[model samples]
Target: MKFLHLISIIISSIFLLNPAFGQTDQWPKRTIKFVVGFGPGGANDIVARIVAEGVSKQLGQPVIVENKPGAGSVLGADFVAKSPSDGYTFFVSAGGIITNPMIKKSMPYKEGDLVPVALLAVSPSIIVVPPDSTIKNLRDLIARAKDAKGIQFSTAGTGSTPHFVAEMLKVNAGGKYDIIPYKSGSEAKVAVLSNQVDATSESSAVTIPQIQGGKLRAIASTWNKRIEALPNVPTTKEEGYPQILIGHWAGLFAPKGTPNEILDKMNKAVEAALKSSEVQKRLVPQGIEPTPGSRASFVNFLNDERNRLAPIVQRANMRDD
Candidate 1:
């Protein structure tokens, strides 16, 4: 009986300690978690799902997107920032990540807590109004803002891209208007459609359908070139307002301290996914131009973007909670 007990212990110890005993090199033995800083059915969610589907197939593991929307996307971002620094947990963050720290004094995690995995894509903002809005174009909106008794604008949220755009427009257009912020771009769009507000800075994804359905009218796209999706709309620069270039972007990130091999493997998967014809085709119609680059390059770009926009964001006096 004593000899049998010793043999059983040895077998149990070997099974527990030696992975090579039966396991193969399955890198992703479980599902990967892709954390999105917004709810489902939005731009962030769409991009996360598209990339996750492709990456999951490539890695032979599921890449699930968990939404954590609130406090202008800080909730989801902080979740990813505080998550274990394993390749299994990733963040599909955007300009909101860098801007959040500047807007609020106390963020859950600093920007350095996150590491870039890849630069996924970008979508520019557009100025759109309700179908029946008397303010037909950018000039008219500016004029009304300056002359009207109580002009107001709607934003996705305070410190969001649209909020910054409206703030900057207030400064450059030389007019102070009432500011109302909603929880999401869709809410802001609804406000505009209902004529509760005058204008908004929204992505093509949010505005294009409304424009097509005659619920809203897109006056200008805030990109350097006319978006292929909205060919008829002119760029803000072409319309003579370069200051209207607020845009939205999405990228891949992992919490700092992620292993190098995992990052490399994940990045390769993202690169392949972004370049896939299906993603390109679907995204192009939504005004997103697919541009994939290296992790190092993405990190450098993030730092550069942070530096370049800090002064402007500071000047806007964006802040709090």
Candidate 2:
């Protein structure tokens, strides 16, 4: 009895010291879910699905993506934040996750509720107009916006990256435009196609097909350099509004209290997925750049993103309503 008691004590100590030892070894005995805050077909959803497939393969388990789009992705984020931190449920979050709290009056989850797992990808916004519209370029669009009535700029919703783009135009270029909120980026693009709105700044991945199909005209790529998918389209910097730089980035996050070992494993899986050539082939043509980095790197990136967008959100007086 004494020898058995000693063995039990030593085993308990080992498990306590390395909690992940048993947990991670038996982890993911079931399917994993990646919850996305935006609707399907948007850049966030697209990236999530692509990476989910890769992670599923890497982990040798089924990884599925669930879209819970609403409140600028706050709803989906809230869902993931409150989910069990048992390494099965993760959030495929976008830049909005950081900016939403800064802009909204109240958030469902607190700052530390969800922790960064990895940075997945970054997609620059493209300022686009209908193919037949008279707004041929950024210059024309800015001039039109300065008119007394002002142009109507469509966006996914309040606190969204596209909304930031509209605000950036106002703050950096003196372009006055009334914002028109839509259900999603796809709807915003359709509104532009039908001339319901004058223009919209959307993820290059979401708008590149429309531009190539000649249904929309690219005015400016809102990044430092022109997009590879649309080489002829000049960047906002080249168009003289360098301050209007922003990108819609997606990252993975797990609920707080999740084991660091699980986070590290997921991060490695994501990094491996991003490095896959097939993933690159599918992502690069759409102007989506894969950005795989360590968990700490993702945390720093989120902090920087929040710092960069906080001022813009404040200056615009962005609100959930």
Candidate 3:
């Protein structure tokens, strides 16, 4: 009886000292959810679905995507930030996650509430107009914006990547346009397609198909290099607007205090999913680039991205409203 009691105490101690030995190891026994702060058909939704499918396969669990669109993705971010840190709920965050706090007067959840898990992918914003519109290029659009009536530019929201692009044009190129906010990039794209708005800067992942289908005309890719899917489209730098460079990047994040073991596992799963041929094939043509990196690297990347955009947001006087 004494020996048996000693063995029981040792086992209990091991589990207590390494709680992950039990909890983290058995994690995700049920369905896991990837929350997207945007509507369907947008870049965030598209990437989340693709990665969720792959992650489900890798983890042997049903990984699902749920959209909670509003307040520039704050709704979804807050939901995830407040969710249980049980390795079951993760956030598929865009650039807005970093810029929202910079622009918004108040955030429902603190930035530290969510911790980075992995950087998944990125897509440069593409300045596009309706196919039938007379705006030939970036310069033409800028020239048109100089008119007294100006032009209408649609965006997902005030702090979204498209909004930043629009602000960049106004500050750097002397372009003046009225920003029209929509629920999601998909809605903004529709506004441009139906001629409700003159143009929009949307993620290439969301705009490449429309451009290829002749529904929209690509004016410039908002990056240093030309998009692989739209090689003919000039970059903003080539169009003489070097300051207008930004892209929408998606990263996985979990509620703070999540076990490091679970975070590491999720990051590995994401990296594996990104390397799969199916994911690459689907993402590449959409102008999305897979970015697989460690959790620490993702944290560093986030810091760098925030630093880079802070000045732009300040100069543009961006606000959530």
Q: Which candidate has the top score in lDDT?
A: 3
Candidate 1 per-residue C-alpha lDDT over 260-310 given as tens digits, one digit per residue, 9 for 90 to 100: 777888888888888989888878888887767888888897887788678
User: Arrange candidates by TM-score, highest first: which order?
Assistant: 2, 3, 1
Model 1's lDDT to the true fold? 0.81
How high a TM-score does candidate 3 get? 0.88
lDDT of each residue in 1-321, candidate 2, tens digit only:
999999999999987875555788677778999999877888988899998998888899999999998788889999999988889999999887888778788887997999899999989999999999999999999899888978899998888788999999999888578999887788888999999999999998888888999999999988877777789999999988888999988999999988987999999999999999988888999999899899999889888778888998888888875
* lDDT of candidate 3 over 1-321, digit per residue (tens): 999999999999987775456788777789999999988887788889999998988999999999998888899999999998778899999988999899989999999999999999889899999999989999899999998878899988778888888888998888578999897778898999999999999889878877998999999999778888998999999988888888888999999878998999999999999999989999988999888889999999999888889998888788765
Model 1, position 157: C-alpha lDDT score: 80
lDDT of 3: 0.90
User: What is the clash count of model 2?
Assistant: 0
The alpha-carbon deviation from the true structure for residue 189 of candidate 3, after best TM-score superposition, in angstroms, is: 2.3
Q: In candidate 1, which residue ranges exceed 4 Å CA deviation?
A: 1-26, 148-150
Residue 308 of candidate 3: its Cα lDDT?
84
Candidate 2 versus the native: TM-score?
A: 0.92
RMSD of each: 5.2, 2.5, 3.0
